[model samples]
Target chain A: MMTSTDAGLPALIARMTGDEKHAAASESTLDVLWVLYDRVLDVTPDTVHDPRRDRFLLSKGHGPMAYYAVLAAKGFIAPEELDDWASVRSRLGQHPDRNRVPGVEISSGSLGHGLPLAVGTVYGLRAQGIGSKVFVLVGDAELDEGSNHEAIVLAARESMGQLTAVVIDNRSATRGWPGGIAQRFAIEGWATATVDGRDHEALYEAFTTPHPRRPLCVVAVVEPKSGQR
Target chain B: MDMRTTFLSTMEEALAVDPRLVLVLADISAGTGPVLAAQRRHPDRVLNVGIREQALIGVTGGLALTGMRPVAHTFPPFLVERPYEQIKLDLCHQGVGAVLVSSGASYDMAAAGRTHHSAADVALLDTVPGWTVHVPGHPEEARRLLLESLPGDGRVYLRLSSQANARAHLGAGFLTLRQGTRGVVLAVGPMLDRVLAATEGLDVTVLYAATIRPFDAAGLRAALGEVADVMLVEPYQAGTSAHHVGEALADVPHRLRSLGTQRDVEVRQYGEVTDHDFVHGLDVAGITAAARAFFR
Candidate 1:
């Protein structure tokens, strides 16, 4: 039953089943996570604790199957470990706990925490004069939490140049963002790009594009959550 | 200098020497001389996130994760309660630590009304694990506690108050200021001055505690000896530490009476701190009346 797209990443994701309450949430970020781990992030399993290594913070921590799959694919965790996810012995819980999981930056399940944490991560890195870029992945619906706005506005205003926020927009937020998700960040002065979420090359370009002296917001627009399997 | 001023100066000195120390503010004390100077001197380290408390805490967590020691400051309500989830998930759950220095403890900004009051801060933090709560009674104690917390990567909440004790009792454990045979009276932070004033002629042991968490059970037990009559005069919500007292005296037949800010009803009035103190039964006269009745 596997499609051509399901050969590599989706096959890995299929290993962790029976806890698909946020299947849409996880599916929406699969391409973005793969692109980041595989192509963009300058982090490896060996450099998880390296002070000079770039940090990838998963702010959208719900339905983290896609994230775990990506991490496993990139050799951060064993692919077999994904099978027992949410089980008693599994470090991969329903939500990611950074303490228990390697290569995971912040322990998050609560929405709106990741962006602020990511903003802080950049500031912290900047304070030490370590020029490590911090990337945070948040869901569009997650932005509804006012805490994210606090971070969104502050990050841009403070000119957190080293921070990049990838907001996965699947049109799931109850009161949908009025001018689209990218506009939200753009209005706050963050350098933004609205790329097709499933387009790998577009995502790569959006992420790699230079947006100096300000934080970057890459809105990967995916299929509406309701339209997904 | 007051505890608040001492906190700023101590933080400034720490920032000057320790590059790893980062101060994140939600525009609380962003304009103060020490803070402004520190920001000017070390722009990268001192961050004013512009009235965003949740972001302030989240930023602190981020800093700690990256091996920087972060000190986040604001009022209790804004700093603690407002961004509670951030404190829980971002810092504690993330397995990193930060020094959360909060001023305007309880009703310090009495004229600001209940919107600014945060009597439930310590009690709220009690719900989370691995937090070191320090309610310093004097400026010196606040300075010492802040200095002690900066170097270590641990969860610490240094609560500073406008109301202060005449003298600072510097110790991590409950220091027995006066020994008596009747019962043990434990006074936390600013409550010490009033507790002492209230128990001047009474034959009750007066113990001062700047550090409330890790509750200092052994010190409380040692102060009590065999007699189990204990009274806790705290500055935060009343009975906030009653559970801790119960746990400490689980095996002993101890009688406990707790005195602190009222829990059942909000004062609903903006007045002087003295008025709020009297209303909460935290003033000298209120403490004397409560102590005499309970001890008798």
Candidate 2:
């Protein structure tokens, strides 16, 4: 089993290469995942069940090689498990399952489930008076689903200060949102920011910026899915 | 009070006592008496998340994931059908549990048209596993079932309706109300009183079921005497539990008859709840005619 003492993100992700259809999907989330797990999130393998720990929900769960790699790099899972990710005997599947994988907050492959769940998680923590922060990662295309809009409206309206939605925009959406994706969240009363997805410092600064009483939306703009950054 | 009212009032009580409980809504009954007061008192605990049903269920699952036992309320179509994928993946697949309390059994909002009606709720839920379904016939029964479901973290769907029996049967499995020698008639939830009234002079055993998901096959088998003729009177779509009946009586030689709302045809014309019931052959006269034809 590969541990924290071994290979880095690129090598870890490359180990689980065969049969992965959406390499772009996994690649687009690489820096954001590394930044969140490595720098931002307060969770570790031991605090998976801790009520007060920050939550990271991967709403864009398709082509999860990068996510698995980051989890392995952060010591949430055994690095060796990535060797047989999609195998019949492996706990890891194409999409992540929270039950099988430690530190996964919600099991998602469906397009629009993550943001709504994150909003709820924020609401739950606020209700219990716990100040745990929640971060959800969604693809720009996944926002087309009406369910995400419902959550977008709600999270801002409720002023869920503890929630952060990081939209990984690879410019892959079918009918792209006019005036960009950040406006969609900004108009709905969310605090919005757009940053270079691949630049680690930009991603980190955008993530930690404070927006009290308002849910924050950080759009990590990456190269289009057709090109490499 | 109605079943909806009973559910709200009971939830209000639960919120006051349990710190782990949360109430999520989709503006369905947010402005009403108990809900309004509960929301005022427990602002954090009671949430009214606009009219978004998909988000309503997704949010419910999220709360459950945090170890909070959430009870989400809305109409049947919105609660059970609209965001079924969320129910499948978020709650069931996540291995977390919440109490899904839905009003409007079948066509409770008769004039609201087909969009509001959801006879396929239980049938659609049947497609997924690990759900305990309760079709409560009266407000008191709805209260009792909600109380029973709240203490534990399990996936429980409590179907509350405006159409109700005069009294409540608070037991699980099939409860035998009347005995006979000819055949067995199972009345599910709100269909109990009508089934009893329809089969008054006939020689048949009538069974009542409020909890239908974990279909009590053992109870049904014990209720059956020498005669293996069985008839099911359900309040939802026809033959919803026919498979359960078939599986329950797999060894016995039996003839099964199912009577409920029509699945193939859409009755667009809406006037009254009773009118819809009659159109669906769930009224006393319709059930009587169908029961007599099968039993005799």
Candidate 3:
């Protein structure tokens, strides 16, 4: 039986079914991905390769059913493709490869690859006189990768105004950050927002609010991975 | 000019002409003032990302995504090995390429210990597909190749060596300095002069190559002729060219021997480059002895 939520996401997610599916993983990112694809990002199907178009990099690319659902719903990718999400002929793999998947910015599966890549993307965009905003979505546990620390500190140091890091806090790390995820970004000079992960209005406001001069971090606190809210 | 100086100056020149070229430094290389000067002149173009080699690669991959060609600079261990995942995922897997210019090739800083050495760096990169590796024999070759790597979206590893050939081989596709019917000997990068010295009295053809990637199969095929005995001498690890050579001469029956740094022995002691080179059988005498034994 298909379960429908207030946002009609459960129907979209029902398209992907398998034994190894990260159900909790996809559910955590669904709302944030919807909010960004629906209201925040200036990217569309046509503007993907446009120089000035906004870039939305999915740094936390693990069991990316929610990302696929969001991309398909927004018309960036076809909905039927989600049926064969992990099949041999499916362009949609468990982890997203940007070359094969439309609207996907970087090919990411490794934990720490995204934030640093986003930092570089923002730098490149700024270098070209293209002021398009670059957004990266990372998991709270993903910050455990030392490479993310390198990028987080560097991104804050560079004063990358157009870069935004939306860290989904699901209490996934084994040994969590000392002062929580938002504090890490705050210590590094980013304008931060800690919000309820499932709330649509709060996410939209946090993402759209002016951080001005410094990069912004919206820590979307979600349910723990232990099936507890 | 030395290869390292030319590396800095060529970057400065390229940055001046190409607006799309982004220079990222890891602060592990010998010189930074020239590059930092370029950063000062064009604050947007050059970035010194501190000693973060992993972040260096991450930044380079990011720049490549935005249609900007990045020349990510540092030593081999730091530039290639430390951030290898960054290179593999962010650059190659993402279908974006950057100019990875690495100094202190192999044992260039032999006295600086194994941490500073990168003989296996090219071998590591060869593990990944679609990378063009160039080990320049001279500063002129380094300058030319570095300039060539900037425009294309292809991934390049421009390895600079402290020990250089007294004269440059300007020709392409393996310059044949001496021709013979006994066998053919291919020397890569800074190993050319020593290779030439090693094969002085031997009845074998000598070929000097600065560019190692897309590995000159046609040149090897044409030069092999009837007698197919071949020796590949590289400045990095031994047998690094074995894969390409075997592929190039797959049909022909040939005797091949590769000589370079020894992989088995760690040589835990530190000394001058010559000391390390002697220990690794990289000196001219060692090359000659190995060449004599292989041909016989």
Best by DockQ: 3
Candidate 1: pairs in clash? none
User: What are the runs in model 1 whose C-alpha is more than 4 Å off?
Assistant: A1-7, A18-22, A227-229
lDDT of 2 at B12: 86
Cα lDDT of model 2 by residue, A1-229, tens digit: 2322244877888789855544888889988888888778999999999999999999999979889988888788999999988899999999999999999888999899999889889888888789988999999999999999999999999999899999999999989999999999999999999999988888889999999999999999999998543
lDDT of 3 by residue, A86-192 (tens): 89999999899999987899888889989999999988988888889899999998988999888988888999889999999999988898988888889989999
Model 3, residue pairs in steric clash: none
Instruction: Write candidate 3's Cα lDDT for B150-239 as tens digits.
Output: 898999999998889998778667888898878999999998999889889888899888899979999988787458999999888899
Lowest summed-lDDT stretch of 10 residues in model 2 chain B? Answer: B167-176
Candidate 2, pairs of clashing residues: A2-A80
lDDT of 2 by residue, B1-296 (tens): 99999898889888999988999999999988888888888898899999999999999988988889899999999999998999998889889899999999899999999999999999999998899999988899999999999988899999999989999888767899999888899999999999999999989999999999899999999988779999999999999999999999999999999998999997898799989988988888999899889988
Q: DockQ, in order, for the candidates?
A: 0.88, 0.81, 0.90
Best by lDDT: 2
Give the Å shift of residue A156 in candidate 2.
Answer: 0.5
Error of 1 at A168 (Å): 1.2
**Fraction of true interface contacts that also occur in model 2:** 0.78
